[model samples]
Target: METELNVYLSEVTDDGLELSGTLDDSIYGFEDEFLKPFAGLRYELGVLHVGSELLVRGKIEQDFEAACSRCGEDFDFTVKIPDFTASFAVDEKTEFVELTTELRECILLTLPTYPVCREDCPGIEKKEEKAPDSRWDALDDLKKG
Candidate 1:
């Protein structure tokens, strides 16, 4: 599955591997309807090989488009997944591990619950409150008669 991870760990480089690259993929599967990964995924990671398991920690950056929770307006956002980390145990026979799912999940977990376009977003404006229209006065007068 090295094709998915886009990085292969050699049998001899078991001590650790340092990698940095850009991942171009349409990442989806988030519970939030407004948030989506529009820009490419960029990362710089350190992988520590311990036995059959790999311990990974690094930074991930991506651009996103999210709808404002109050006004439903789309806004561009940048997500910085600093210290993004994951661990995996690969089969001894496996050549390389795939990290597509792990990377996608790391970004999804960092999505804002209620995304706002701006700190001072007024949202949808409310209609002005007013007294009853004068046209209803005639009906009230008729009822009194």
Candidate 2:
């Protein structure tokens, strides 16, 4: 299901609002990179309207796909970020607050710099070892003489 990232201030209440759903693919994506979300992000969040600030606390889970740093193979990665929290100042006159960018930043920051296909990936194979050339043997004999 498509999750809307806009939370209207009018809909928020002092008692807090519960948010649980999968974020839309269009909301978070890469332009020309392999690193992307395999499945939309799932969030179980609590949105509280506290005086002048919006306090957001929740858990976010997501499946991601990225090319392996060593082998360049595609692999799946899972992110289960717990205790995710964000606070935004309430603009008294604003009608809505957009969370798409903020949430995207949060998730992207949790990704690894170098992703791997597997824990024990051997990576690229090394070139085969070569035997010592016979020309070197002649030099060794000359040195011995």
Candidate 1 off by > 4 Å: 1-3, 11-15, 29-33, 126-145
Q: Who wins the lDDT comparison?
A: 2
* Candidate 2 structure quality by residue, lDDT tens digits, 50-75: 87788888998888878888878778
What TM-score would every model get versus the actual structure?
A: 0.71, 0.77
Name the lDDT value of residue 120 in candidate 2.
Answer: 82
Local error of candidate 2 at residue 41 (angstroms): 1.7
Top model number, TM-score: 2
Model 1: per-residue Cα lDDT over 1-145, one tens digit each? 0224544657327567887776764545443567777657788899888777777889988788889887788898888988998888766676777777788788777878888988877776632356779999999999999
